[model samples]
Target: MKLRCELLLACGLFLALVLIFWSEALPEDRTLFLRDLSAEIIPVRSFWVRSGGFALWNPYSFFGMPYSANPQNQAFYPFNLFYYFFGAERGLVFYIIFHHFLFVFTLYWALREMGFQREGSFLGAIGFSFGGFFCSLSMLVAVLSTLIWFPLIIIFLIRAGKSHWLKPGLGIGLLIALQVFAGEMEIAGISWLLSLFAILFLPEDIRGHLSVRRIFLALGLGIFFGAILSAFQWLITLEFIPLSNRASGFGLVDALLWSIEPFQLKSFVIPNYILPASRLSLSTSAFWGLGFFSEYSYFLSLYSGIIVLLLALFSMGGVRSWKIWFWVLLAGFALAMSMGNTLPVYKFFYFHIPFFNLFRFPSKFLFLFYFALMMLAVYGWQRIQHKPRRIFGFGVLIIGIGLLLYLIFSRLNLEDSSLGAELIAHKFFLRSSLRVLAFFCLGLGLIFLLGSNMRFWLSAGLGVLCFLDLFFAHRYLNPVIKRDFYRGNSYVQEFNNQKRSLVYPPRIASLSAPSEELSFQWLTDPIELYSRLRDGLENYWSTYFGIADLRAYSLFCLSEVSELGKLLAEDSLSPGVRRLALARSGVEYIYYRDYGFVNLSLSYPRALILYQAKIVKDREQIFRIFSDANFPGLRSVLIEAEDKVAGDKNFAPMSDFARVISYENEKVVIDAEARADGWLLLLDSYYPGWRAFVDGKEVRIYRANGFFRAVKIPAGRHRVIFNYFPESFTRGLLISGIGFFLWLFLFGISFKMGKGRK
Candidate 1:
């Protein structure tokens, strides 16, 4: 009977949530991430076209792309690639659903791991799913996806708490790896939270259970493994990985703005409200500064503020374990609340610290506060062991109802009241069922507190509530929210409304065309480009943030024009540091896109179209047209070769340096210098694999480091030759050595520790 009841409630809640998401269109404001993910995957598609290689991709694309070189491109930072490559149609919808499932499962597992009753786990999941963070991020697919990892990390930490050093070390390592795949900002924030929790939560005896030395060793091995494994591909792609970017963090005032909660809730039944005339926004014009608030009216700062306050109260007056959580939540809340202010503590922590440049958007730490609050709520409910006297219970319920009614009818203006009333019908049955359910829960809790005899009933009732909250009505809401909120702002709508000119790094397209101004006028107006631009940078900004560019009106939004122009010029430069500027007058080729908001629209082809637009009639013949914006037309190719050894007797003069072994299908090899220290042999090809040897001795060199490759010989010179293949063997051996040693070290110590314990 108990099992059946549990199943019915869980099923009901799950169904409701699914319905809400399905009915609602994907939310628009946060939907940029889905679009961005789609944009980043274009290169992978291009890779398939060029090499037919479908291996798991890192952040870098091998085809002379910037993502391969720039650290900011961070792997999976472009998430939608997997969606579009695997599921061309409805890929985003499917991905969002998958995230919803992950959120539910992870929440369930995390609560269970924390030793909550089955029902407690269920309610905890429900509360978190509907928490302000998820609700706001649901509209943002990439951020939501990244956020899901937090629960799994908590689960691992709980499980690890019971184990020896190695197990926990490995668990923490895996969590770190997952965060890295999500990108650096996420990894940093999550790592900080975990470290803070570890210091606060883990008992000293348990930590001492494994000697500090062994624990440190295990942690070291885990970090070493994690670093190499997660970054190996990145290391190989760019030849090295960097720790920081030149651009990171906000000014004190800017960060403070992020810290302030823009929304607050006065009463639960009514929607949350924003204070337009508050300190954060002294006037309507001041509030409109960012264009974010002006463009979107659905900011939920009020709701967030209310939920946080309730959570704070719920967390107070708890046992040892609960108190730890309370303090952690308080710390997070304080940090979030200080985002825009210039407190000495925040300034010292964020600005004065050396590596603080690694993090941006300190305000996003609110995610930690949100999670803490959800867990505290669960703990509070678990602690509620007494029932009010019958008269008191009825009176309290009446008071709650009365307060809700008064707020709904009197405090709220007509428009707000009408809005709340409309939602009243939408949730009337579910809310009614919950009220009745709450009474039952209260009775059982009171019974449990009074006598141990009713323990089973308490557990049973808790389980039932869990089912009702998580698995039933929530699932049904999915469809409704998806239709109403998610789908309403199609990329087309955004495209039609924006008036920003974009400044993209120079590609073959940009070089072949002149400037963005001509490109926007001919190919896409500002409004149309707006939606496409959001899609392009969606995944990019999940970890890497910048303000939107508004170059179309000869205006700037979040970017500095001179700096951007410099970056463009640098990218368009040759290895020799010479600038290669594209035609600037006129061009007469038109590349039309049927899908105005597709990935192809954001690809190099669109940039090229605008580039070609800058060309005049004279340069028209130099450029052709590409239907897919991602596949830009090749305008002109430049080739230059030089033999560095001119004066030395490194075999011959520049003309006498002949191609030794040439393969049309792959690459060409040349026999040249067999000299020493300064004797350089340059075998330049577009494809990979070129190695040089001197007198049967292999000379190893790092490709794309300080130099591509250099061979040393006696000043007089001997025999020198270069071989061309796909990859160099030296890099492969080094990678193998690192992996093998790391594995052996971790396992060896773990085995020794096990023996010692035994």
Candidate 2:
């Protein structure tokens, strides 16, 4: 009953903090939420809505494009789904609230285990829930949600610390399971490794409680859970190792250093006018320097340094034990070392240390340090209480005086600088002053915490602190916020609108296969498509660089299509003997509203000469269009519609078009009109050896482009013949067969080994 009460208080306090902070920052993102809302509405679950049909089954490319482009790999599956069921506007509101809940829940549990008073624990939960780390992560829906379950895992670890035997192993296993489910494996690996180190730092009595059997059991369970969790990724990896060699470190380094620069603190006092390169950078710097507690100059910004210094000074006093101080310092040192330019020999103690190289963004680990600082500040309050209950009143007065002076000076400086009174009045004083005042009140409440044992005051105080800190500090701390992180840039938003702007000038031309219009609706729910249609198209788009479509970015750049051949060959093609190229034409064609936002170019062989290429190429009255059937022989149509609407637009029903059935051993058929139209049948060199005829006349099959194994048919109805040579699909079939057998063999072996061990 007592534990349950404590939990309730913690939850209540956390909610209060979230409400306060959220009221200030909830609608901070205008564009991203709208984009996500738009995605939610897209019926054709496609990353790129080129032509909405099942004609090209390339779903892998859909998901892969986004993952490769952005590091925001944490999926917003639930949020996307939420919007699907609920209306977008209400769905997004629920998502924000839910994430807040998760953020607080994890913290409450972790803090409770750290020996904080229930109220203090609640406060800690609130603080972290609305902390810079949470806000920074929240910029991307996926990353934020992925991290929410992490603290819960850590809480279990703390619990396991109670008994190291069987429970700890089970705890470790549970952590692994949660991490797998969360889909933030790399970050989880780093956190788990840190947790293990922390476990080792426990007192000897606690350490002694652990045994080899327990450790082994925990490890075994972890492996078991990991296998179960990662089975799907493993299965796909059998096709080709899904290993990403791109170092996350440089991006991590850039993300880390970017926030710490002196300019961000100024922006905090000012407005979004002073933009930084990235949000992660800004938030990281805020955590390091102008944190909630101190005021000291860092590379010239005394605001952050001063805050950190004050907190550190407060921590100098001892509470019940010296271990807390030691742990805080240890955590700080770990963060500094990890961020610095040195080989992390200490990291090698874990099995996944080398694997950490895959993710270069080390700054993300600062979250652990941030957690430590919050606890340490509370520790400071706890420590001062030991001096005497009588001194509490005086201490509260002094703390209050100090806070007042800082705010006054900060406000004065803001007004005096070129930062401007109008801006300062609106952006800083009006927007941020209330949060600072609330935080000041929290410090006063902490004094009460020292004097009395009342759980309510402590909870209330902590809640206030969490609210003020997050609400006041995020603008300075998160670059994502400053750069309109969720809103997306100008062009991306434009792409989301269903109607294309004819700014340059042009008219929409109707085609035989009218292209699907890109809609404005996707602006609110871009990831909606990822949820509904699994096999149709890739969905989900974000400005966060690591997990969106690179093709999306290409909208800003223009390059010759032929130049792409070399890159595609190098990156995607197998060890072909030689001569990579693309066919001049295809069996299918695509049309676009304009160059519009789609800038990705198709590759074709140099051997194929361009007869004519025009921006608004037209067959008759159609504009800005492309076609598989040129001004020549064309017959027979097969349209696979990913969306039923696509069939309605482009494809004629089977009854409307002619169908060629296999007649004799010769597998040859032709449409009589093909010859007169002067449309020639062109085959790719990779195509199987074959002969062709039109209206009983022998025609040469010319190999033009290397990529397209195409047979051109004349305008009007024409018969087509295709004979599949045995060698064509041989390697593909062989590879697939071998892979299937090997998977079975491995499964059997693993099963037998497990049985034998048992």
Candidate 3:
């Protein structure tokens, strides 16, 4: 009966998620494709599908990058099997829905494991999963996927510590590996930090049963095993990091971007109260925050429901148990740290802590604060069941607070007429506060009138109320678009037919300053803007259409490629200089919103044979040479001084011809005829792990033209092939295989032991 009830509840939760996202649940409807989804993930997934299997290289973006090594690609995540079986479009919707259900179910399971009643656990799960943070971040596939494992990790860590068993430890290890594969290492790091806290400050009952030394050993071993399991993903990521834009970590100020302001705390109680004027604008303009709306607006609706806050406060009133205080303290710590520069604590951690500088957005710490609140609310529910009469007092106090804020804001009068916008914002706040008060009264009435004996009915009513609260508040966050949004674009079709490299305007041209109200008009109606941009082939739409774009969006780019892009985008450089640089990089078309695709007159072929070579010792010198208007980039190549190139350096001009026979994601083939010994330069981003073969014999690849690949060509026609097969991936695969078997063996032992004991 208990198992049946739990299963029913799980089904109910899944159904609720589907209903909340009913528009997106349709086969033709999709979430808005604005940031990472359109620019990075969809295009990469489309390439992977077109390549017929898992591929290592993404030649369409960043001029050829390691696709598997890019963490955000999520190349090895097990859940991506859905994308493989069903196509990228439909599969992404199912993938997101599945993870959201997993989040709610896992949190409920974790709360039950922590000794909460089923009713309370269910309430806590609903509040947290449908809360502001999780709901708003649903569009961010990687972050949402990585965070679903948090509750599971906490549960297994506690189980392992208490049981002193290898099975749960192995489970934790596998969970950790899955998170690493999910492609958001920052969230994975936060999970580990929270798990550490959960174990260190466990409730007295569980802590008393644990052997401290054994628990620590289990945790360390589990972490080590997890590292071994995910060695392939992280090992290549480590190699790529130093070459990436974030090689040296962010500056202190940059790292503090998106820190929650002190005034934003009101968001915890009032919906749409953070930057109320911007919320009223129904767009991203006038966002008076530390970072842009795309970065900070996701977590704006921090209202987890008025009943949740009231119950949590009620739990804090009496001399609570140590477990209750544990959650309270953790919540306080997370709230303070989320203030970033507003508080001194985060600054100290940013300078002193090891990995704190690697990530921006201290507001991410609110995940912990919200998690702690969910736990506290569960405890509060348990207390309220016994002292049911006290609920009305707490509910009245919350309503009174909301009314007080509403009165205060309503009474504020500004003598200066310039505060008109501020007055409108205050009015919005007052309206939202009234809405919160109504919900508070409704929740209080449900609990008080139903009484304690009617547990099932009371729980059902409150569940519906909480769902409505969160649904109405955040339903518009990730709006749905028709499937036709991605298809039938003439620009995409045109680019696909050309099958050549393209260059678009830099991202800065599209970004609007916070003060630019007219510029932000497009943001007010994102669907219309997205539709217009689709016809213009904005962002990485070229990649999705199988067109190689010189400028594409990525979390990080190779330092050399980044510098090259900066030079190309610089207004200080002449258009001729920029065109010359683009021609050398094999850019055949340039996209402009007003003019559409324009053909470049001096575009270089993808493969070229240069008769002359110049060895430059300094990298900057190569850029300087390229910046000059008179440099003959078509005939002469610049080779790095450190790279050794065989053959004649001063070869006379010959009838040398090179043509690309085949170009694929991971491999490229060129048929070349060199009448005299010269150099073959391929305008592809050069990095480690790419090997060249001439007539089935291995040849050295040299860094040419600052950040492209080059190899020596003999005085005969030869077939040259370039393949990307890194040794790190092979070695990591072997280690992961071993770890997999070890985990299986541990599971066997655990199962047998339990069977024997039974």
Best by lDDT: 3
Candidate 2 per-residue C-alpha lDDT over 641-707 given as tens digits, one digit per residue, 9 for 90 to 100: 1222111123221112223333222242433233222223222222223456555544544322222
lDDT score for residue 214 of model 2: 45
lDDT of each: 0.38, 0.38, 0.71
Residue 604 miss distance in model 3 (angstroms): 0.8
TM values, all candidates: 0.54, 0.54, 0.87
lDDT comparison, 2 vs 3, better candidate:
3
What's the CA error at residue 191 for candidate 2, in Å? 1.9
Q: State the lDDT of candidate 1 residue by residue for 141-245, as single tens digits.
A: 435655666666565455444556565566556555555555444434664465445434433443444344544544564565555545533443333222112
Please state the error at residue 125 of candidate 3 in Å.
0.4
How well does candidate 2 score on lDDT at residue 599? Answer: 26
Q: Per-residue lDDT for 152 in model 3?
A: 88
Candidate 3: regions farther than 4 A off = 1-8, 11-14, 17-24, 27-31, 162-164, 199-214, 273-300, 385-431, 450-456, 498-523, 532-536, 569-572, 643-651
What lDDT does model 2 reach? Answer: 0.38
